[model samples]
Target: MNYSVKNILLATSFQHKISVSIFYPENSSNKSIIISSATGVLQKYYSRFASHFSSLGFTVYTFDYYGIGASNSKSIKHITANLNAWAFDQAAVIKYAKETNPEHKIILITHSIGGQLMGLNAEIKLVDSIITIASQTGYWKYFKGFSRFRMFMFWYVLIPFTTPIFGYFPAKKLGLFENIPKQVAYQWRQWGIHPNYMFGHFKNTELYFSTVSCPVLILSFPRDLFASKASVDWLASKLTHAKVDRRHLIPADLNIKDVQHFGYFKKEYQDSLWKLTETWINENS
Candidate 1:
């Protein structure tokens, strides 16, 4: 069950450098997993989860997007990287994982916005399977009650107002997540404002989603205020060519209070939720 972690800098096609960590298991399996972090979440947030998977014999890769975490080379204001740039960065990581372990089957594990990036990549076919945790379209209409109004303000009011003034989205200062490049914040705002999310924003999104043929398991929690069941289902339905299994988890059913937006990655869920994740990966692999 021993494993070692090594950090490396990955140069993307856009010339942006990504900070990546590869976990090597003492007894490696034929399956390798690349975990894509949610927006503003650091690669380090998944280190323990990646290590746990490595101990189970899977080589795991984790990385930060171009303007986030260890990949940030300069001030966020100076960074013009958008969603496409982040997707390209992820594509580079996938290519590196494929080249580094050519014999292994690659599984992509994504959180929130991380799951949405795969459809944007032409190299998604290289992934054998995908597991998306709370990944959903961010269109505010999908939410209900107070959550919808809050998200509406987030997209329409907060983002547009603050991004221009600060030259970046100061999410860290507001205690939301990490600070984000203004371009990313703007593009994300447009997507959230649209009814169909990214699919409505771009012309080629249907083709992008149709290209993915791998089996996908999408996990959503009822307690997650950010990703509603409707939003998750909207995303799941868009994966036209993939065999998608979307599960809506009720926290109380599992004898837990909640597994909100970021709780799934917490080490406390190792025995319950993590076990389910490992079993799914094995079955899908």
Candidate 2:
């Protein structure tokens, strides 16, 4: 295994310097993999998981979102949390990965929101296979009525009226709005009006899954807020691919605890996740 860390500039004016690690299995074929993080999480979060894939003989490229991880970017505003920005981040990282490893087939493995953005673009042939864990589908629209009133106060009134005079306003404990430019927060609030975190205006998570034509493996937990059992089944039905596999992991049969959202990537429980992931990759590729 050979490892190197470097920053790659993205066309979206985002800094996404990721740790590009390469591995060569004595008898393995050449393969390239890119792992993008969920929103606000850095690329390093997948260090262990990247190591797992690499051990299985993959040259892995993992990077953070615009505002998160090693890349430098304008301060993360509320708007950056939206799906559009996330999709941009994904496109940039994909381009970077292709440039770095032109000879290999590129596959994507992501967690949560990373899966959502993959759905938005409708560009599949570029990728060989995709694996998503605890990824969600559909709207958070349950908040629509309560959200409209808040948006009026924040964007139409607060940001427009207060920003120039106050220079900034407080956003949580992080001073996000005040410390960051008001424009960023304003955009964020505009998008936040929807319940869904990313791609709020889209039809549903299942609809997004339907648009995907490549081999996709979805792992979701019932305890997870987004990927309910029905949602997983809905996605499976829409996949259209006879080979796409969907699995739901619940907690111990003792019923003491439920499977966690992100913990599936951890070593303790990831044994099964890895086995299934590698099998899918090898079989499909």
Candidate 3:
């Protein structure tokens, strides 16, 4: 179970440098995993999860999207990053993992927007399988009650008013999320208002979803206010060709009080919910 951790810098097609971390076990294995983080969530936050996967005999890779975390430029305001750029960055990371471990199966584990953006990756067909955790489309109508109100304020009011002043979304100051790039904020705002979410904005969205033929496992929590069951179902409905396994986790079934959108990734769930995740990956991947 011994593993080594290393940090490296990768260059995008446009020559922008991105920060990536690799976790490899001492013994080689034929399975490798790429952990794609949620929006405004840093790679560092997922380091524990990466290490856990590496200990399980699978080489694990985690990276920060451009204009976020360690990958951001010296002046974030000057950086122009959109959803396409984020997908390209993820694709570049996948390409690196495949080339580095040619014999290993490349499995993708994505969270939130990471799953939504998979269609944007030109190299997605190269992946063996995908596992989406709390992933869903962000259409405002899919949400109800307090969650809907919160989404409205976040997308319509906060993002619009702050980006003009800070030249970027001041997520950290507002305690919403990590600071986000202006373009990312704008694109998210657009997607949130549309009934189809990102599908409405991305050209050839259907084609992108159709290209993915590998099996997909989607795990969602009943208590997740952000990614409701309806939202997650909408995402699953789009991947018509893929053999999709969608499961809803009830905290009571797991002997836990509650599990939210970000709770599953926390260290406290390492033994309970995390073990369930490992079991699914072992069976599917």
Candidate 4:
């Protein structure tokens, strides 16, 4: 229940400002980590989740993606938005964590698309471990006819046309696009697809899954609209290491109707994740 808040910036050069925010644990014994958010909301929205790790003594941190949060969404205008660039941002945050908290253990808690992206460029190596929650693994409805076509449109047309206009549509009209960058929006559409959309990033995400060496924990929900148990298991199978753990299929007991993807951040399951993280960190680290 106790924490500290600090504004952060990690830059390659004095001119490039990388914005981030941190929540440090009370009576801490652990070091630090980077928590990647899903499509909507700011770094602060994950505060309760971060509090779990921080409260257990680990410093928890998060940042806005180039066109997402508090960071330079403007880069969206010029750079070609792709999966790799986001990994670079994550790597930068890892670097900053190492420099800022020299000796604390480091971990990567990547959610959704962030979890699927580590293998794009091949340079990620600082985190001690990784935890991917409700992340996309693969989506080849066995490469059926309809699936392949959806992939074509998201990658070739619709995303290319629409992302430049909407980077991440907010749940409650979050004003997430006031400073929308054309290029970033374009890239997001290419990467971001409705779960049931034609064909999702099955091959690419699996490729990245194979390359990550750190201990990994893959949490998947059975009722998730975005990711399924089969997808998480596919990712786990690809990891060369045996350290991959599974938090299998958390079901939402919600009165509403769905236990769908990204619900780990919702009111129903956030605390469950907190407990899982706390217990996992305690047992493992």
Task: Work out the TM-score per prediction.
Answer: 0.97, 0.67, 0.96, 0.74
Off by over 4 Å in 1: 205-207
- For candidate 4, the C-alpha RMSD (Å) to the true structure equals 5.3
Per-residue lDDT, model 2, residue 15, is: 33
Candidate 3 per-residue lDDT, tens place, 120-159, comes to 8887887988989888988878889988888888888999
For model 3 the TM-score comes to: 0.96
lDDT of 4 by residue, 62-114 (tens): 88766555776454445344444566676678777877787777778878767
- Report the poorest 10 consecutive residues by lDDT, candidate 3: 199-208
- What TM-score does model 4 achieve against the real structure? 0.74
Better of 2 and 3 by lDDT: 3
Q: Cα lDDT of all candidates, in order?
A: 0.90, 0.57, 0.86, 0.61
Best by lDDT: 1
lDDT of 2: 0.57
Q: Least accurate stretch of 10 residues (summed lDDT) in model 2?
A: 172-181
* lDDT of candidate 1 over 63-96, digit per residue (tens): 9999898999998889999999999988898899
State the local distance difference test value for candidate 3. 0.86
